[model samples]
Target: MFDIDRWREIFQSINKNRLRSILSGFTVAFAILLFTLLFGIVSGLSNSFKSAFADDAQNAMFVRVWQTSKPYKGLQTGRTIQLKNDDFNYVKDEYESKIQYQSARIYKNFTLKYKNEANSYSVRAVHPDHQFLEKTMIDEGRYLNEKDLQEKSKVIVIGRLIKADLFGEKPALGKRINVNGSSYLVIGIFSDEGGDNEERLAYIPVTTAQMIYGNNDYISQINLGYNPDLNLDEAISFGKQLERDLRFKLNIHPDDQSALSVRNMAEANKNVGSFMAILYAIVILVGSGTLIAGIIGISNIMIFVIKERTKEFGIRKALGAQPLSIVWMVVQESVFITTIAGYLGLSLGTYLLSLIGDSLEEDYFIKDPSVSTGIVVGATVVLILSGLIAGYIPAKRAANIKPIEALRAD
Candidate 1:
């Protein structure tokens, strides 16, 4: 019920032993603070890992060629390996069912001129599906279509930063820009989550680059996204199979990674997912240990406090106080201390995480450290329950003591 007198007694008792109460409360607070910080930092690490792959489609794979590092079939080391339109056609024909989206890329650097404004930017000649593989978002107009690739159209799509630099408040769409002296129409402007370097690029049709740059059918790399219906293991197996087949077709040694390599997003994603799961499990174990230690510390303090007040409890019993009243008072005090202290710890930890923000992203790969609302609520419940248990045990034992024996306690 509404027992103001009981509350007054509890408050008076707490005031009488301020040092003991502070010490108990501090133990709980520090444990909760440590728990919060640990979880928040791990969550930040998870965020960093996710953002690292945000630039590309989860199922994307890349096939790259470079100079041979090992001799194979009488061919000497250091021979430059090259990918061509025929190789791209071979992949498309061989894995038509397994492929979702495919693109051939040819890298170039061109000085783009829009009237007086001019700057050098990285250019990629690619197929239409390159947009999805790169996760490029078109802000205006449209990306390259099959018609552009077939017609070898002199149409280009520029990045958001490129548009801003060359156009500067002017509409870049439908405007003609000179690229290495040749005029090309800007069909679209796009942005990428891959950061500034990605946003400063321009893309044209791969066929156009092949026709104009070298008058030959040469490509720098091939990118493809596996069918989303395939599971991770299946996707990985597909990538390996494709890689081995490509090595055989290109006359490169099976172990010669420098000659030809396939980079599979599926393998990277699986490894990262496993790593994060293990990390979270470890953090949860450590956090639970901290909470248990806090509970034990408070329990010990309560036992000591009850022992010290045994004589007082005996006097109250001699004066006709109920055992229930004694237990209730002690439990109330414990709960009060734990609740307030836990709240303070939670608040302080969250504030510290907010202050951390993205400051650790560059060096530690920790981004936007934080704990979830459900976790906070769960922690609060645990603290309250622990307080109740801590108080109940010692209070029960003290209440049961005979008045004479309790009175004799020193």
Candidate 2:
């Protein structure tokens, strides 16, 4: 029902106690503001982590060799562990169905040049499968294929940043670039969202890299993507099994922790995921706590308002006003204050978060930070519920006031 009389009374009450009403409203607004900022901060942290490790797939795993720390099977403690191309072949042969993609890399730091322009970038020799594992996008031409690997072709794919720097307005396709004095034909251009670092790299056939770098059968790193059916923790266990297998076949000591290391992207993702969950919980608890404090303040003020209006409420009763009317008046006013004040805070908070979110550079841990519509709607609903509770008891007291007793008081 539209209650003009009740609304007029609410406005008159606010007009009379403007300072106190504003102060009460400020409490609710501040609580909402604080909560909004906390939510955005947590979102930023999550985005940062995802960007930081976006270079690899969540199910990806990598293995690198190091010097053995302990002697085993009559081998010297100081013996260096070296993996061969045979290791990659073994996995592809045995676990072909279980794996999604795999690649072996041998990298060399090269001062690459096209005519007079030059840039120092890391050049990696990789399998065609490496393209999918790195999640790289092709801007032009084609990536390294099996033919390039088998024939050991002197063809290279440059990153987008490299193409822009070296080729400028000219097309990079079919052009020849020099890497440490050796000329290689540019076959493709690639790009990544992971920032300029990934853009500064170049990819070539792994066979050619191994041959040219004088590292026959010696890969610097082995990276692979396994079944997506496995979750973060399950994928970690999957990677551990491969690590153990490689150690056994390569004559590396089982206990030689330093001799071999397999880094599981799934494990990294799980830890970050757990931390993000914790942060989300903390944001909810803290936001709820702050809002609750403001509700308490409103409840306290309503109690005081009821006390001061006791005589007025009694007079209304004497004049034949219904108890429900008195209760409703109080409740309506509380709801209005809560809704309006909380909304102002919500708007301010959202604006600030949007500004911050836009300015936040996409990094490893943080990405775009915007509040969902559900959160905004939910917060408003919470405010309205809190208002109803804050006003109920005080309104009930006002409704119950006796006319004779109220009149008898000073």
Candidate 3:
């Protein structure tokens, strides 16, 4: 219901105590602003950390050769631990049936030349099965196949960044690019969520890399992923077993510091989850503390407002105004102030978040930083609730004033 007279009364009250009302409103606005910014930063960092695992297979782990750090039986310290084709075959023969994807890469520094332009890139020789393991997405053309590996084809797949740098806007597929003066047909252009470094590397058949770069069955690293159908517990168990199996097969010590390095993404995610949980708790605690201070500020101001309006409330009561109406008036004014201030804070916070989100480059640690709609809505509800609760006691005090006591006031 539109109550012009009631609105006029509320405006009169605000106008009379302008400085006090402004201070109260500013407190609420500043509190919400602080809370929202802190939360958005935390949320952005969380998203950035999660982005690292994007498009990657579940329970995937990578293994690389590591030199011995401690001396053991018949092995001296500082000896380089080499992983070759036989070691790879041994692991595959034992675990191939249970493995979802397994691959090894032969990496070398190679210069790629096209049309008189030369650039150095990480030219890696990879198996046909390595595509799925790396979560490689072919934007155009095709990735290396089994046939390419068998025939040791001189074909290379470049990243989008490489394509932009090397080929410009022209089509690159089927074009022969020189790798150290050897021609390799551009068979594919691929993209990955693993960021620009992963994208910038050029890929060729693993066998070709071994023939050209490696004298024997030398491999740089081995990668594996669990079957998709496996449950989380099953996947974790198999990953552990595979780690042990590989170490045992390689004759590496159980406590060897550098015999091998296995990066278990599933375990990393679990640790990240724990860290994020702590972060969430910290955000909530800090936000709640600021919110409480704002609520207290509002309640203090409302108490003063009620005291100032004591005579007015009494006169209204004597004039047959309902006690409930007086309470509603007080509560409504408090709600209006807090709601307006909170909305301003929320708008400014979200605007800042949008700006930061657009400008920030996504990395392994932090991505787009912003609060969800639910958090905004929740904050709004808190604002309204804080107003009502802050006003309730003072409203009751105002309503309890007898007309006789009010009339006696000078």
Candidate 4:
């Protein structure tokens, strides 16, 4: 019900003790602001971590061969394990249906030149499907295609940094650059926030890389993207199986020391998730501490308000006002004051977060710090509860005071 009289009475009472009311309200407001800011910070940190690993496809896994730890079956332990072209072909053939995308890469650092302009940078030799695993973006021209791989064409794609260094903002596509003294045409430029600068590095067909780099049939690593819908555990099992089968077919010891390494995006996601949970827990602890201090301050101010309003309470009782009505009056005043002040603090906090969020870089843990609508609502509810609790004890004491005694008190 709309109670004009009740509002008027509450306003009059608050106006009589403006300083005390303001102080109490400020406490709740500060708590809400601090809590919300902490939540935003934690959320931002988690988001940044997730973004850093976004280049890799979800549920993707990487596999590379190294030396073995122990002798497996009849193979020697110290033998070096290398991934051969045949092994990659076997994996592709055996697990073609289960795989989403797969690519083998041979990478090395070499100096690239265009006329007299030369820069030493890393180069990768990859298959057509390598683009899928790389999350590559082509800034100009086109990426490697199946035809390029099959023909062992001297076509190359460069990273943005590579392009900028070699071509200086000029179009790099269709230009020929010499890598390790051999000329290759630039077919595309790869661009990303944090990736191999396409301008600085060159990418070529895996076969070409083998021919130029002297590796012949050797590959450094194989990257595979799995369907996200598949169970992570099952995917991991499938990867292990591929590893075992590849090692067996390659005449490499299964337990060859440093023989093989596998990295899975699903596992990374799980680890990141665990890290976020811990970060949020710390944020909550700190925010809760701040909230507790604010609540105590509000409670103290409410106690003072009750003491100052003893005479008013007595006068109301003398006029036959119910005990619950007196309680409601005090409780409403606390709620109104805290709610307004808390909202002001919340707005300020949000504004600050917005102003600085975009400028946040990857080097720092924090990123876009914005609280969700649910967090805002939850904070508002918490403020309301704090106000109610702060007013409760004082309101109860006022209600119990004998009208005669309160009226007599100076």
lDDT of 2 by residue, 1-410 (tens): 89788799999887776776788888899888888888877877777787777777767888898898988888888888777888889978877766888999887899899999998999998999899889889999999999999999999999999999998989999999998889999999999877899998999999988878785778878889988987766788888888899899888888788999898888888888898899999989988888888888887888877777788888999999999999989988888988898998888988887877756654423467767788888987999998898788889988988999877656
lDDT of 3 by residue, 1-410 (tens): 98999889988988898998899888888888878888888888888777767756656778887787877777787778887888778778887766777888877888898996789999888887788988899999999998998898899999988898888999888899999879999999999988988889899988888887645788988888766677656666777787787777776777885878777776777778788889889888887887778778888988888877788888999999999999999998888889988888888988888877756644324477888989989988999998998788889888999998987765
Ranking by TM-score: 1, 2, 3, 4
lDDT of each: 0.90, 0.86, 0.83, 0.80
Report the C-alpha lDDT of model 1 over 219-296, residue by residue, as the tens digit. Answer: 999999999999999999999999999999999999998889899999998998898889889877886777667777
Alpha-carbon runs more than 4 Å astray in model 2: 1-4, 180-182, 310-328, 348-374, 396-410
Worst 10 residues of 4 by lDDT: 192-201
Candidate 4, position 182, lDDT: 85
Alpha-carbon RMSD of each model = 3.1, 3.3, 3.7, 4.4
For every model shown, the clashing-pair count is 0, 10, 1, 25
Q: Give the clashing pairs for model 3.
A: 48-367
Error of 2 at 95 (Å): 3.6
Name the candidate, 1 or 4, with the larger lDDT value: 1
What's the distance in Å from true for residue 263, model 4?
1.2
